[model samples]
Target: MVENSNLLAEQRRALILDEVRRRGGVRVNELTRRLNVSDMTVRRDLDALARQGVVEKVHGGAVPVMEASTHEPGFEAKSGLELTAKEDIAREAARLVAPGSAIALSGGTTTFALAQHLVGVEGLTVVTNSVRVADVFENAARGGSAASPAATVVLTGGVRTPSDALVGPIADRAIRSLHFDLLFLGCHGLSVEAGLSTPNLAEAETNRTFVASARRVVAVADHTKWGTVGLSTFARLSEVDTLVTDSGLPAEAREELAEHLRSVLVAGAEGPATSG
Candidate 1:
């Protein structure tokens, strides 16, 4: 009986997830009627999904995790998204780094792309909360770049989330003690009102520490992220020294962002040479 019940529960949850994905979000009452289950059962199913980072439970129902900034996609799921824009943004972000600069990178596909570009840069002291980003540099250092100045990679110890970001008191404490010349920040969403935001609450808190630790904060995001508000705000537009995004950003929105940031760098699809 126990095994059969468990199988039924799993089946129900799958249906709920499918419904949520199809409709973007679903109300609890609607789910109860469709599933022919009590409100409590529906809530229980939603709670389970929430724990897996599959769906974010709101007041009445649940929404697809990817639709809101409060729920983040896994690292692999996000990697394939916005590839062209991320590569262009990464190329431009690389131009801002000088040799031997101490830099901090917050986790996101955009920042990871930046990491790939920076592997060839000599003499970098990198501090990060991303395991993948550190691994990228670590692999590059093995039997590679013999003549290039050795880059120091610092990986923080903390609880890893679905986004593969290390966060918690451990990461926060480490960031407080060190300072960096620049911070290459990435986010789930960006808005003039929300500033730089992320869906995961812990990531938001850790990113705040990253903001405080860096002299210059450069945010790298794609155009699709504009105006999308996440659950937590890490830094305001005023806190960022520069905003780097692709030219896919609307002109009017660019004008609005220019009002808040020190500088806005638009990387064209043509690549770094064309972007100023």
Candidate 2:
């Protein structure tokens, strides 16, 4: 009877996942009614799927994971998904920046979070393809923040992606003409095989140019991004100087990443731990 009950639960969760994929997103109440299960049970099922990284649990429901190679979610859609993890990563990545240095930031929620931390850093010059990231500094300056005067922000001009990233020939030329002390890149996916990837092909090209222009590269991503490959790959794992991720990543996975990456910083309550 126990085995039978477990089998039923598995089947039910599978159905829920299918429903989420079909609809793009589904509320808990709707899932409960469709599956004929109690709200508690549906919530538990959503939690399980979220743990597997196959779906993302939202306010009262879940949405399909953007695991498809070509899948791309807009900036706002991604902003609320990994708030804590992104903040942790941003804090750690910020430590790598120095005053009076030119750095490049790529588009993605994680990089956007990092931009906030950098607002107070004195004498910093930032070049980015992300309109959202550029806005962080621009807004700070307008707000009369004393530290804003120490920062210079440059927004690349080009076609924009769903993530509010400027990409294409214009962005590419601008990046190639300049040099950066470091680059903080955010990706849709990361893995030993695919490395850093994005759903947009033009963004991939622009990211490649960013990598080439920088003396060092730091990839900032939460654990959920692991094993998720996007349509286009920008840089190999070997190309990154450091990887900063949240503690939600499994131990085994961190071990594997440390083998390819020069350094892996796992951010947690205690602080970021380094492995390489």
Candidate 3:
């Protein structure tokens, strides 16, 4: 009976998720009446669903969160949101690095920014799977007059994703043989229950291998990534050491992340690149 009750609860929760996704959102009162359940039961179900990355609970309702980001948001289109926030997060994230350390960068825009930030840093080695990132380091290495930063960049060889990321069995095997002091990365959705996930399964698989090889995982996302769940999971929230995002994150979202991650770093406004 107890097991059956648990199954029913899960079924109801799925129903709730479907309803919210279908309608975009639903009122608690309406839910209570439709499900013919008590208010407390509805709230409890919503809470559990929220923990699982199935829903984003509002004061009196719940909403679907996996909506797509508007554009491809090309590397050039990435200078949005609290620019200063990204800069601050970038600086703080950079502090996690030490001279002569070996790091791997995930193929995210924030990690790309980190590459630009490391241009003149004394001695560092990085491995990456991004054409843009490789270009950044290649350009910096080309001052034609200076010595290498004790840096040896390894680009994972694979077919590129729509976002210009290299992924597949080749990249996965490459990452399996590698390890890093740290990995700066990001995702489309991160949830307490769903873990770290992205819409692209191929990318998620590659990230799984990447995360498995890193000593520490640092997520560099903005406020919007929270409370969302994506198609395929890469890692659970507890797998992270730190999260750096813009200050615009809701207090509840910060608290929620703090529940699983070691710490949440909110980047202050430092103003973004304008004339770019």
Candidate 4:
């Protein structure tokens, strides 16, 4: 009976994640009513979900971890910059995702765009440390247009940053312990010499751990970040499996980094500019 009950509990936990992803969030009372369980039982399930870093426990209910953040760029601030370029890059990134693959996406505006394009892909398991990214997946799943997002979406827990990125001890430990098939990461700054950079030290460290844990690393950065500098350095240029950027990259600098990375995919223009 004990083993059987444990199995049932696991099934219910899966249901809860599905529901949260479907509705973008659920209140504790709502879960009790909807799942047809006692409040105590619901609390236990929510606790388990919280432990796994998927849904966030709030005053009334649990919301997707991506929407757990207390801050984000306003609509205008984010929409005003690089709209077309971001979309083209997002389309390119989406094409790289294979169904039923385990992927990790880091926090950044560009990654958020990539998440939007993933709505139609089937059987993908996505792990992310960004509250915004999680919400994007949750919304996509809820649109109910496809097979209800066969993807298992997991969020990493930690302190929130200005960019709404989850960082610190919890995130680092969670990322380091898991191995991912592909990691789609973005940065606040990028340079051949400085490698991956972020203004926040904690976020930089968090990105580094994701880099170490993934079998392949794909950096999705816009050209604006090319010469930008940040507070700390995360990974070396050679560590990245692919660098996805816009055509705004400087010819000289792009040539320099091309010698190191496995491949560089430059989108947002007419064609890919490759180096020998």
The reply for model 4, stretches above 4 Å from the true place, is 1-79, 145-148
> Distance (Å) between predicted and true CA of 65, model 3?
8.1
lDDT of 1 by residue, 24-135 (tens): 8999998777667788998998997787565898989989776655677799988876677788899999999999899999998899999999988888999999998998
Clashing residue pairs found in predicted model 4: 66-131
Write one digit per residue (lDDT tens) for candidate 2, span 67-170. 66887889988887767778989999999999899999999999999999998888999999999999998888888665357478889999989999999999
CA lDDT of 187 in candidate 2?
98
After best superposition, candidate 3 residue 219: deviation in angstroms? Answer: 0.8
TM-score to native of every candidate shown? 0.74, 0.80, 0.70, 0.70
Angstrom error at residue 268, model 1: 1.3
Superposition error at 89 for model 2 (Å):
0.5
lDDT of 4 by residue, 44-128 (tens): 9888768645578988778766632223343335544566667777888787899888999998888999999886788888999
Sort the candidates on lDDT, descending order: 2, 1, 4, 3
Q: What is the lDDT of residue 171 in candidate 2?
A: 100
lDDT of 2: 0.86
Against the true structure, candidate 1 reaches a TM-score of 0.74
In model 1, which residue pairs have backbone atoms overlapping below 3 Å? 69-199
Q: What is the C-alpha lDDT of each candidate?
A: 0.83, 0.86, 0.73, 0.76
Off-target runs (Cα >4 Å) in candidate 2 are: 1-45, 48-53, 56-67, 145-148
Q: Lowest summed lDDT over 10 consecutive residues: which window, candidate 1? A: 1-10
- Model 1, which residues run further than 4 Å from truth? 1-66, 270-276
RMSD in order of candidates: 11.8, 7.5, 11.6, 20.2
Ranked by lDDT, the better of candidates 3 and 4 is 4
Q: List ranges where model 3 is wrong by over 4 Å.
A: 1-82, 144-150, 270-276
